[model samples]
Target: MSAAATDHEHALVYPDEPIYSRITAGKLAMWLFLLSDGFSFSGLLLSYGILRGSSQVWGCTTEAIAKTFGCIEEPALGINFTALLTFLLICSSVTMVLSHASMVEGDRKGALKWLGLTVAGGALFLVGQCWEYWGLFGLFGPHHGLIHEGLKFGATHYATTFYCVTGFHGLHVLTGVLYLSAVWIGTAMGKTDANTLEVAGLFWHFVDLVWILVFTFIYLIPN
Candidate 1:
């Protein structure tokens, strides 16, 4: 074949710069994954809203006291506690972005520091979630049964939806923590790159965004 024809054929097969050239393959993959995950979370939140709106009562309980005393009925979900958790996640997102900035600037130590802070924030958020769960379901010591007999999971669809939605988001936070830890280790060992850290940041930020929706829909909205 003539050289000109060969070049033309090559250009047809692959443009000089593909449409996705601006984003690394890995980052593109992460974006696609986040898009699909966003859909899943939207569906869950939508279902929660539907169930919540239809339910007659969505009862909540106060913090767990001694086993003898147990928990008392409250006005709504522990909004104060959840609001704190939401703040933690938002702060972690800031640290996550700082980590990415440090990585881009070739500051390995700074990146690691920010990433560690982000991981800590995620861990704290998870701890808060667990505490809230324990308060609601009495999953741990002393309070072994549901906090309120009337608010039992089987008794109401609200209870079931609440747990399912929040539990799913909690699982995402847990997974994001693990994912960040791995990236941090790789960054420390000089194996991870800016793109990797940025992709991780995308996932972390998505988790934060989802929680905001959950907090608004599940906690702030009145039953």
Candidate 2:
């Protein structure tokens, strides 16, 4: 590169070089924010761990156990149902990558198509989450939802921690959905570049990953 091409962002910085690193300022800022957010999740999970470990009867797995703990008969988590939600998130990550690839390839319509699907996936996942919590009129199957099945929040350490961790992650998904929707609108208007979608992908993937961990610890772990 010639000195004529040099344009320093700061007097102390090398000409024609990034001030901080290879990533653009937007991406770097997002990474830093996610790091702090990660710490918050870690704290919540740690508290849950401490409580679960110290309690002799964290969750009532059987009638005899519930009787011993004097807990109302709470339904065991429907692992099959929650597993489907996890799969939905993982698939959305794939669509997000496709959308980025399509944008870079100059396929405007293709990018919008995949990106639209990605948004739909996120929306569907949120609906599924609501169904898990409240049953949503009991439309799908016999299950009437967790809360109605006796997993009310604040009733026990098990119930409270379950809602806190999963509910927090649910909020992230909701935010991701809205963020993607705005990006979709901007993309349609030619106001956004591939980098914008990539940043959105980072947040979406982060939420998906956190959900995986939350699933393992909160649902997969045995009482």
Candidate 3:
């Protein structure tokens, strides 16, 4: 047989088209997982809304609330600081898109660089959350942390919902960081491909988008 014919015969075969709705199995699976995950967040946020809306006061900012609840007064959510974290996630989302674009363009180095930035952004956001919850290393600025000041989980509806929602989202950020790190390493070793990176990007993008909502409902909303 000719060399071309022999090589063609041995070439691996792939599905001629996507498994469903012009989407690959991997992408479809990720979408389904995201949908279920979305419901969890929705339930949490819905409960938060109902509680906050029905309550006479959301935060223990006033003296009467502090006295009535028998709980130490907790400050309102800090929009300024959380806003910074939001911006970081937004920037990370951009880097994630660039990473996927680079991979699609067959530029492995560019992909790696952008993906690294995306991971860093996620890592930093987690650290920021830590700083928000508890001062870093319990060193300087410890009192500013929510835990140190107040806002303890199970303390109040405001505090509980804040922790449950933001904490849940923070866990997602942490997961995304680790997930992207694995993909980053795999890509560096030449095992991962654009499709793989795209799936990771979908997850990272979902995380960032969810944070926007969390920040809005949990922080920006007037208490």
Candidate 4:
């Protein structure tokens, strides 16, 4: 090539490229990954809404259903066990963010500490959910609830949809706990670095975000 042509090419290429530039390829990839995860969550919530909406007994009287459970408990559709679950998930999200910050500051100890706390929170939430399951199913014997009462009242379908919808969400929480625990282990073992933490944090936040919607639609909204 001619010297003049080579000189023109070099002039077109500036030499002062920023070493630590903003929005690198990796960060852009993370955003796209997060978007896919959001779609997954949206599908779950939308499917739930569609399934529950088509049910005839879902919007029936909660108070009337409560009578079958042999208790004076009112069906106040406020925050219940579901709200507690939401709180735990939110707490986990906060810990995950703290872990990310710790790693960014190059404090491996602090990062591990926060990761341990996050795992503990996840474990505690799982235990609470287990207890909740026993409470609902009456592990020692037959389950008693407005559900059984509903059956007697010819509202069997009502009980079915109620358990199925919330039970599916509980399963999601269970799976999320396991996923977070795995990430915690990797972070502790030094296998995951700041980038890994960032990716994990994105998933953790997505879980919490999904719970917010679940809590609102399933627990907060009155049927």
Every model's TM-score? 0.79, 0.90, 0.88, 0.65
User: Candidate 1 residues 49-120, lDDT tens each?
Assistant: 777677544454434422324433443476787899999999999999999999999999999999999999
lDDT of each: 0.81, 0.89, 0.89, 0.65
Cα lDDT tens digits for candidate 4, 1-223: 9999998985553334477355445556867876886776677667667767785445445566546554333333335665787788788888889999999999888888887777777677766655544445675345344433332222444344445545655665566667667877887788777777777677667667766876787667766
Rank order (by TM-score, best first): 2, 3, 1, 4
Off by over 4 Å in 1: 1-18, 60-75, 135-151
By how many angstroms RMSD does model 4 differ from the true structure?
A: 8.5
Question: 33-122, model 2: which lDDT tens digit per residue?
Answer: 899999999999999999999988877757998788786777788788899999999999999999999999989788889899999999
Q: Write model 3 residue lDDT over 1-223, tens digit each, in one string.
A: 9999999875535455744534667887999999999999999999999999998778997678889877678876788888999999999999999999999999999999999999999999999999888877676554568887877899888899989999899899999999999999999999888889999999999999899899888888775
Model 3 misplacement above 4 A = 1-21, 64-71, 138-144
RMSD of each: 7.1, 4.5, 3.3, 8.5
In terms of TM-score, the best-performing candidate is: 2
Colliding residue pairs in candidate 3 = none
In candidate 2, the residue pairs with backbone N, CA or C atoms under 3 Å apart (3 or more residues apart, or in different chains) clash, namely: none
